[model samples]
Target chain A: MNRLFGNRTAIAFLVLPGVAIMVFALIVPIGFSFYFSLTDWAGFGAFNPVGAANYKEILTADPVFWRSLVNALILMAVTIFIQNPVAFALAALLAHISQKASQIFRSIFFVPAVLSVVVITKLWVNIFNPTYGILNKLLRLAGLKSLAVSWLSNPHTALGSVIWIIIWQGFGWALLFYYTGLMTVPKEIEEAAVVDGASWPQTYTRIILPYMFPVISSVIVIDVISSLKQMEMIYLSTDGGPGQLTQFIAVYLYQKAFVASQYGYGNALSILFVVVAVGITVLVQRLFRSEGEIQ
Target chain B: MNALTKTPLFDRSAGKRFGKFALYAFLVVFAILQVFPLLWVFDYSIQKTGDLFGPELIKLPLVPVWHNYARAWVDGKILRYFINSSIVVVSSVLISTVVSFCLAYATTRMVWKLRTLAAGFIGLGMVIPIHTTLLPNFIWFNVFGLINTHVGLIIPYIAFTLSFNTLLFAGQLKTLPRSMEESAFLDGARYPKILASVIAPMAAPAIVTVLVMTFLTNWNEFIMANTYLSTDDLRTLPFSIIRFQGQYSSDYAVQFACMTLVALPPLVLYFFFSRWIMSGATAGAVKG
Candidate 1:
């Protein structure tokens, strides 16, 4: 078995193809991104190197870059704080319900997650249209015409509206994760808590939560990365409009590169993006690690 | 474990009964919030255009404008884009599944140096954002003249999926006992033969799980497709919606039809394979 399994030729054939693809598709492009980010390439003709100028402009000078960063932070906070806890509570509730009902609710909730992001974004954009949207129509019926503002266009509501759409689409995935995590908890733990006179809510808060630390942390980690990677929804809906209030890093990078035709600057933006993404990933993992130690 | 909720302990009082009622009420309302948009799109897909002023939230049209679907299929070019999406999704899913299966087997089962290093390098692909590669990939595609072609989109789609699928596959493959393969070797069965007939069958469910996942991700992928596939004919299904939303800005019903058409496959796949999809999701999160 050892000789057969360890055949060098066979192992090379099996592994090399997949590894080559990753190196070509992932590593090589990053290498190119770093190399070209130094030069002032305009997607075409001759250009000279302008080392660190793009990075300097982004870090210290660009207001939109900062705005996009702040927006991403806000999104991360909402997803981690609001979306997750609520989903966890719902999963707790679903765990208590009948199996049939739980299955049905799980399927319904996961529909948006399975649907295309474009579908959800465009649907919300339509639903927020001021003239004929169902939202404003319903608001007027309730005699609150002032509240029936253009959700995606108005300054005060634009960021909130875009964030709501992002949260709406993501809610299902969080619910699924929590629900699945809840399923893994032993029944005796809960029953033992109940026998000890702890109420269901108290049991969940004190015992079940600590048990679910790893799953909960993983969910938050996913929420964090996805929040940072947010682009398609904002791009389709607001395009970070209403004076760039809804800008995010990924979409901003794309707009700089492809839309604005600043290839070199875009590469710089992308390199910075990798740095920040890697940085936050490390930070979040360490945060969770230390918290896990406390637990 | 939650049988505790239904027993005499928790279900005894009227207050607890009221609480359960309230819980159902909340769950029902949230479910409505989750599914209402899709139902609204379906309802309005058949309703007449220019009826946006109606007070009702949704209505079944007395005369359904089913031709809106025809218009979306032909004039909206959803048919063309759907075929384009199929080519990209199918090619990528097939390649990713087969390659990851092989990669997983070699890394997990074979005795080789650099196995851990190779596996670790590919695993890093999971955390890296696709945006990091977008600009350079665009330049490379331009250089190779793969831009605006299905092959261009399919190649990268296969790459992005390799790491996740390989991890999931490796996690599953590691669980199986090696005794079967050892016995097969005693019977003079070749390594490839044992792997093909034994390992593949054992990991069949995981293979399906990763296949569905790769298919969904590739199907809904828009950024790479939008950046690379610039021509109308070559664009994928999700990419066409941006164009349709603009061109038929006033033709809301037809656009609704277009949205519904683009969303149908994944929706159908999810419901049809909900069992595999759900378990696979949990397993991937836990293990991969």
Candidate 2:
């Protein structure tokens, strides 16, 4: 038994498959991407080495890249600042409700999150259709006929409408996180605050919120990562249309590589996107770490 | 009740009641907002466009059009895509689960010197977005004559899911009592025998959680499946749904039915195993 347990070959066999897949499929591919980023490969043809030219072009000349980054930031901000607060507040309220009602509402709010991105996006696209959309119909029925517009195709509302779909789909997960986190907040802390005559707002602000900071920061980090990687919703709905108003980094890179056949440029864009993603993730972790230490 | 007795009845009671009512209203409104679009899709899938819009312009269908689903399923080629999806999803989930379970068990229970380095390397895989790997993976698969093959898509799925699933399994393994394994070893049980009899059964719940998550993710995965597989017969449910929508752009009811069909399997799976799915998602959130 000891010999069998200590066999190095057996241990290696147990570990190598997963490790090999990770290294080959994940690590090696990224290395290949970096190599491709340095060359002018047309995705399927002979290539030339173009040193740093793609990066420089993306930085100085590409307006779409900048727009994509800005849109991603806007999304991250909306999720963190807008969605998080609403979810937290709702979760707090939910914690006070009856168990049956909470269960029912929890299932309801989570429906969107559970559905496929295709379903969600297509549903919204249909709803925003110019001719038979339920939204425009509802608006006219309410006597606000002047406000009806092609929500996804109109330049002014394309980005907002796309962002709204994303937020709507993601709202349930955020609520679930906050609700779960709030559930873990012990009753004794709230009781202590009440015994000291703390108002409801005061108790939440001073005691409850601080205790849930770990969950809050984790959720925010997840939001930042996800927003930066926002692809499927945009791809299905707008495809970054209305003249690239809804372009995201993920979709933009895919368009460059697959659609436009600019593989090298797409690789360059992806490398840069990765740098920004990792940097922001690290900065967020450090921010939370420092804040956690302070507390 | 005792806590309520400490407060004066006339002090802000009405205001508190109103506030509670407002909170409930807000929650109900948000829930409706979250759920209504899917309901609307279900409504549209079963109704003709003419019936949906008239004097009311928002009425439910008087009679359900069950044929829409049959037409979408047959003409849209959704059944083929369903088989394609099941092939990729089941294979990937099985391979990743077995591999990650072994890796997790080794990392958590064994005393290897390189374990920390291996764990850290795998953890780093979580930070790199899938988009970064897409181009190179495309090229690699194309070079190996794997493009448009289910195996091509399955490889990346296994690779991408290994890190997070391993982390989940490792976390679960940490909570199991070590004495059981130790006692089995005292009886001269080999590693394989002990693992087969003891660890596997004990880790059933965690395996279920991993399976549920991987199933959801692989089933809904779009960009990779869309990119790697180009043939109509090879496309998964998502890419096929997109193609179906593109083809039937004028037939809104059929398109909605296809969307409903594409989304129904996972949604049904979620409804049944929502507890596992929810816990896996939130746990992965905080832990990752």
Candidate 3:
């Protein structure tokens, strides 16, 4: 065993199988995407040499690209600003509850996170169905029949509806992070604050919140990354419909390549998607890093 | 004030009481909000097709229809999808765990020249979006004759999953004292023996984390399954549900029933292993 593994070549051999799989599965394919992006290749047709026409068109003339970007930004904003604070507050509440109650609430909140996205997406689709959806049914029962409308089908409302579903499905996850973060707060810190005449608000603000900086930063970063990569839910529910009001980068790239049959343009879109995702991730990490360093 | 006066005066007790009440109110409201849509699906699944599609705003089926599940299970071809999904998920999980454990061990424990470079190579996998590679992967898999095969799905799944798995395993194994391995060396145990008996047992929690994550991802995967598996009998639960929609249009009961069947296995697994999943997710988050 030592003879086999002690040699540098043997250690490299051990890593080779895994690395080869990744290269074959992901990296080489991406290289193909980059190569294909430079051509006018229909998914199944003869390819013509086009010198960066796909990238040029996507960057300059594509309205759908811009729409997808706008939608992604909107979803990211809603998740970060709206969802995070509410989750933080709920998590704070969970901290004060009895162990049994907290456990029950945690499990209840986490159901959506654990269930398949296919289940949640389909569930919301049925709920938002125009003709037979329960959303309309409930609205009419509440005597708000005039306000009832097709949430997923309307261009004006589609993005918001999609964002709401994403947030709703993900709310439990954010709450779980906060609850776990709060659980780690020492009891003596709270008691010390109280003995020093600091009110609960003050203690939470001055002491507990500061201690949770690391958790907050990590959760926020995860949210940003997940938000940027939002695909399955949007694909299942809207397919970037109602004239692409609900378009997201991930879904848009898929639609471009397969549905629209613009393989080169789709590859360009994908490369751009990677850049944007990495940029946002880095920016979030930088922002959080400074915030942590300042304290 | 009588007994409390012996200690420092605490004014926030009243505020803490308010905070506690507010917390309960918030938890209850959010809990209901979160559970209501799922409950609606549960209730809707049990209603007859005609009864469910009625003009009435909130139609309740007179008879609770359990055959929706029966039809989905016995008739809707869901058993095939479930089996397909199990094969893909289990195979991928095993491959990912073993490969990542070795790679992580090599990077962290073995003294080598290119260890940092190798680790960087693994880390690079995490940054590239999967959607970007789908088209090319299809072409490559086609060339390799892996298209529509279980290997086609499992290989990519394991590849995309290895970085996260490797990172977690490396972090976990790093915490195990090097002295144990050194002592094993003194006692004449081989590297594989130390890895299998000493490191593997201690790394159970990390392994569980990897298993849950890989299982959850494979079970819920849609894009690759959609793109790769073209045959009906080969579909996973997610793809199978899409098929059910296409074939059983307007049969809302059967659709819901199919959805329930697709959902129930994971739900049951989660219920039994909630603690493991929760801890794993949070631990992954922390390390990540």
Candidate 3 regions with alpha-carbon error over 4 angstroms: A1-10, B1-22, B54-62
Error of 1 at B247 (Å): 2.1
Top DockQ model: 1
Could you give candidate 2's per-residue lDDT for residues B182-240 as a string of tens digits?
88988988777778798989999889999999988889888898888888899888765
TM-scores, each model vs. reference: 0.95, 0.94, 0.93
Winning model by lDDT: 1
Order the numbered candidates by DockQ, best leading. 1, 2, 3
Number of the candidate with higher DockQ, 1 or 2: 1
The global Cα lDDT (0 to 1) of model 3 is 0.83
User: How would you class the docking of model 3?
Assistant: medium
Which window of ten consecutive residues has the lowest lDDT sum in model 3 chain B? B1-10
Mind giving the per-residue lDDT tens digits that candidate 1 earns over B157-214? 9999998888888988999987878888889887678878989999999989998988
Residues A1-295 of candidate 1 have per-residue lDDT tens digits of 6687788988888988898888888888999999889988888889999988999998999999889889999999999999999998999899989999999999999899888888999889988999878889889889999999999999999999999999999998899999999998999999999999999789988999999999988888778888888998999899989888999988888888878989899899898888888788889979998999998
Candidate 2 chain B weakest ten by summed lDDT: B49-58
The CAPRI-style docking tier of model 2 reads medium
- Per-model C-alpha lDDT, please? 0.87, 0.86, 0.83
Candidate 2's error at B168, in angstroms?
Answer: 1.6
Listed models, DockQ each: 0.63, 0.57, 0.53
Candidate 1 off by > 4 Å: B1-16
- Could you tell me how far off, in angstroms, the CA of residue B212 lies in candidate 1 after the best superposition? 1.0
